[model samples]
Target chain A: MKSLHAQHHPLADTGYQLTVLTQAEVEGAHQPLFATRLREAGLLPLRPTGITVMQVNVGKMCNQTCRHCHVDAGPDRTEIMTRATMQQCLDALRQTPIEVVDLTGGAPEMNPDFRWFVEQISALGREVIVRCNLTIIVANPKYYDLPEFFARHRVRVVSSLPHFSAVRTDAQRGEGVFGRSIKALRMLNEAGYGVEGTGLSLDLVYNPSGAFLPGNQAALEREFKQRLVREHGVVFNSLLTITNLPISRFLEYLLDSGNYESYLDKLVQAYNPVAAANVMCRSTLSIGWDGQLYDCDFNQQLDLLVDGRAPQHIRDFDLAALNERSIVVNQHCYGCTAGAGSSCGGATT
Target chain B: MEKATYYNPADLAKFGNITEWQPEMGRKFFDYYGEVFKDGALTEREKSLIALAVAHAVQCPYCIDAYTTDSLQKGADEAQMMEAVHVAAAIKGGAALVHSVQMMNKAKELSM
Candidate 1:
């Protein structure tokens, strides 16, 4: 599937996506404003708790265009972060005590400077997390050595596998993706990434394929462990259940399939205050491909920059200013606070 | 009463309003329903599948919609949920077929 950008779809525009989220109303559904909900929880003007994870979107050039991708990332994308911007990120990291550097992209490894950036982050003694699309490791001959490189750096690898079954998994992602993902998992296992004693954490992410919230994280993890190990001899440390935020291609999907209003209603109805207080945006800062900063990846996708009170670019990394700035939010914020709550790690509450 | 159709998908959301008139019974029923779905000898996922099967067996549109979403949220995948529906169908069909024995017995006795 081509990306929204590639297809010239209007939803590809971040401003348009935000407008659709905020202004478009379906008949008979009274979707409450997310900010109002937060206010009710005494969390209006949500500010950062502290910076812990610096999630960097290295690029938007992914190998496959998945249907539910909020990033609108695909092979057709050309939004690669430059070495200079990466240097700026490393410089910012050196200045702040932020403990974890998360690298994500169309495929983070696809960036020419990906290895250099990983080594640089590792040298700084900060934990590195590569949000790898598993198939990227097996997509080409050059990427075959990713497991060894990741192991050498002791980088935590996180990948998304929507479902254990090939049919359901492929339906959301792409055809034959499940097979490639399993092959990549075996390779990661051979490198001892997810092995019990290795301490090299490799986690899989599970987001619902269609318009529904994720199931209980613990139960899903247990089921994934049993199925992957029994059927394919794959092992992983944990499963991170992510709620699909309504943005970009996913927003396009909801609009196209007539699930937008109901899905938003579902998210709003399941809003949990505990989860609201623990949103990843409170702690994680998202860096875009061109060094722009945002509250979280979802906001980054929507072009919702960090509040003007904070430094808007990575080059001007101001931990104090950012910590003081209120997190930019919209209706999409409901996804993070719904049900058990969702974040980069897993359920928040 | 003004609507042409008897069943509106939107009515599913209003199911909670049942408590408005019969608060005591509604609360008790909902409390028991919640407890029934909790993980026990049968996992919540299993129970969701069962609810989905029963929803089909009883042919309740509201239930089918509710439990379909519940089953998905409980981690039951497409194939598993569909199989649950098929189980309900198989039993429903078998129940009617099984009554053929009584029909045959009555027919033979009358003929004699």
Candidate 2:
């Protein structure tokens, strides 16, 4: 297994760094066969449950390059959502009756027009969800007031903290991310984001530091609340445990570490039919930074467009046709349906 | 025809296949097994740690394989997990040594 970092070829015309491991390559690792499992579980030909979430990936630019980052986002990555594309997504959001405007990126806050984007979404009176990497607030002095800004617009902030302890969190993110994240959580608390009655919600996302399905979400949330409060005196509304999809840098790690096949086997073996039925793609319409449509963010990253003859661009969004279109899924979908399950909001079943 | 080996670590994944031999009993056993792991008095993670320790004490390779992965997935660190194994080893060794008292009593009775 050679490093995909140095290997080249197959760049998207959009100039986004293309995944060396194609969809087929990612699917090659499947053991029990994701589709067969779905069919046996009576879950084939999965269709939308009506889109309620408009998940928008603003860009691939971030302050930290997490080892398991499915986005492969870092400071040097130039792929970002232009104001035009952002406008397109906003227009689609306005035209469609979608409720939650979910925003994500390398460090979505790193986008130059991120504040404007959040403000515009806020003005629509739609609930805004910002997938903030907690370190970004402490990474730069200019971003220090983000908690206040987030509170101002009543945005739901979901930040990633791979573990409660510094060792595991820093192992997954960078060396000092844990300390910085704790500081940022304190900042968010000060701004009343996670306060008992502020009406502003602050949540933490937990993904496994290695190649395994996430544990039970409710159980882990209790552990996180206990440890974060007991040790740092910080509190948050909830914890969202997301299973890392095998894509981007994480795929590379699996390959490099020789754990790809075994991990994929584990996912397939642990597949829950209930979880497969309730995958997030059923209720989420994901829009890429370049305004391309996808069934979910993982599909967006892999460049798997929504199925059939639907309009692929946000500007041309047709809610009826989009709702009627079948969601595109592949072996990677197992990551979402394994065990208690995982999704953007948290576990599925 | 060949008889199946008593324990094969690979058979851990095939535990569900026991239903192939005796569907009624296998299904019932698994139903109860699944129910036991659900969150209740003890969290699933705590159960996993306990399972890991018992796997060592019982020297069941299959249980060890399954529960080691389970413990890690449930957020048990290497130290915590290893400490659990040590607890099982300590109890097992203590249990074995305490039985020496029976051997001492038998020798005394025979000599008297």
True contacts kept of each: 0.65, 0.55
Classify candidate 1 by CAPRI docking class.
Answer: medium
For each candidate in the order shown, give its overall lDDT on alpha carbons: 0.93, 0.84
DockQ of each: 0.74, 0.53
Error of 2 at A158 (Å): 0.7
Each prediction's number of clashing residue pairs:
0, 0
Please give each candidate's TM-score.
Answer: 0.97, 0.87
TM-score of predicted chain A against the true chain A, for each candidate? 0.98, 0.92
> Model 1 segments beyond 4 Å from truth?
A24-29, B1-3
Prediction RMSDs, each to the true structure: 1.5, 4.2
lDDT of 1 by residue, B1-112 (tens): 6777878999999988999999999999999989999889988889999999999999999999999998888777889999999999999999999999999999999995
What's the true lDDT of residue A317 in model 1? Answer: 93
Give me the candidate number with maximum TM-score: 1
lDDT of candidate 1 over A165-253, digit per residue (tens): 89879989999999999999999999998999999999999989999999999888988999999999999999999999999988888
